[model samples]
Target: CPPKIITKSATYVYKLSFTALYTVYDVTNDHHMPIRLKDSSNSQKTRLQYASWVGDTNALAMVVENDIYLRQSPSSEEDYRLTFTGEENTLYNGVPDWLYQEEIFKTFEAIWISLDGTYLMFASFNDSKVGQMNFPWFSSNTVLTSDKQNDRFFFPASRQIRYPTAGSHNPEVKLWMAKLSNFSNIEIVELTQPAVILGRNMQKKHQ
Candidate 1:
């Protein structure tokens, strides 16, 4: 997407649906100042993050619906789907999972486009084995929307997030590097180092 123009004079940011007028599936020409595009598919959040033009390059990358999309240039009619493992509340690409977001990366996204835009490095987290933690939230409601006949009163609500505990299965982290030449190619590097165990265990893996 083209960089958004900031109007410092009457500074205000607003969310509007651009898909109504122009669609990525329909457009071809890139106008001056480039137009920012959005994912046409309806999503739970309907929002994207970690969007930026590759450092000193014409390519663009963004996280939409927990999946990463890349384009050779801003003028590209459609973006290439770099990852397909992203599932709703499950697998994520270029973005950290719940545990990593909370305790690991301590940041929103876990992706880095190279300074020269020749390569991209990212972290992939597998939290399928991790357990979920739910916090109780008391709410007073006459009828729960999900329940019919208004039979339920004072429904219990809770917030659930994946959190690892002692002796629990920690999220397995993996690193991957992708080169621009082969857009679909991704190589995984296993950094299986038992740094905590200061002896033969660490040496064995390195060897």
Candidate 2:
């Protein structure tokens, strides 16, 4: 299904206006609506829970919910309009997925408009090799082809995740930076030392 479209307006005058949009689904009806708040507005509304935004006073450096989206402004409207598909890769800007944020502890994965609100930065995780495991419990105690007995069945294929433990090998980590003006000019920063550990200890002596 196609995404819904919505419009918002500002209430107060400022250098910029920031707004956030969220979607709320109606479990009873299986429908959704978009929620938005402009700079001048102080109240929040409940709507579809698809997208959210945090904009600066001037409406610049607006952090969108998803990665890729389309922005438009009608010739008559004063504020810009946003429409997005539900895909994260296309709409969000700086946020990473669950694994990258939780497992890797990467909190600041996104870079949005510099001090001047002219540039943006974003990071991505590529864990294509990760695998999954599936077990069949209902088939337990059943007899299969030939002499095979099934008490518990494991899937023939399993997913392998590259996780690093205290003494395990870790994957290579790299940092990338890009200018909003020219996304093609991405710079990759390599670290000479990939891993580091810090610890603290306390000792007390009786006087």
Give the TM-scores of the predictions, in the order they appear. 0.63, 0.33
How do the residues 29-105 of candidate 1 rate in per-residue lDDT, one tens digit apiece?
44333324434543322235456666677777766656777776756676777777776455667878776776657
- Look at candidate 1 and tell me the lDDT of residue 186: 42
Report the C-alpha lDDT of model 2 over 1-207, residue by residue, as the tens digit.
333334344221111222334443445666764443242253655222123232221222223443322112111113332223223322233444434555565452443435543343444343333332234333333544544554444434332333445564433233334333322342333223333321222222321
TM-score of 1: 0.63
| Clash count, one per candidate | 0, 29
Q: Which candidate number would show the highest TM-score if scored against the true structure?
A: 1
Candidate lDDT (C-alpha), each? 0.60, 0.34
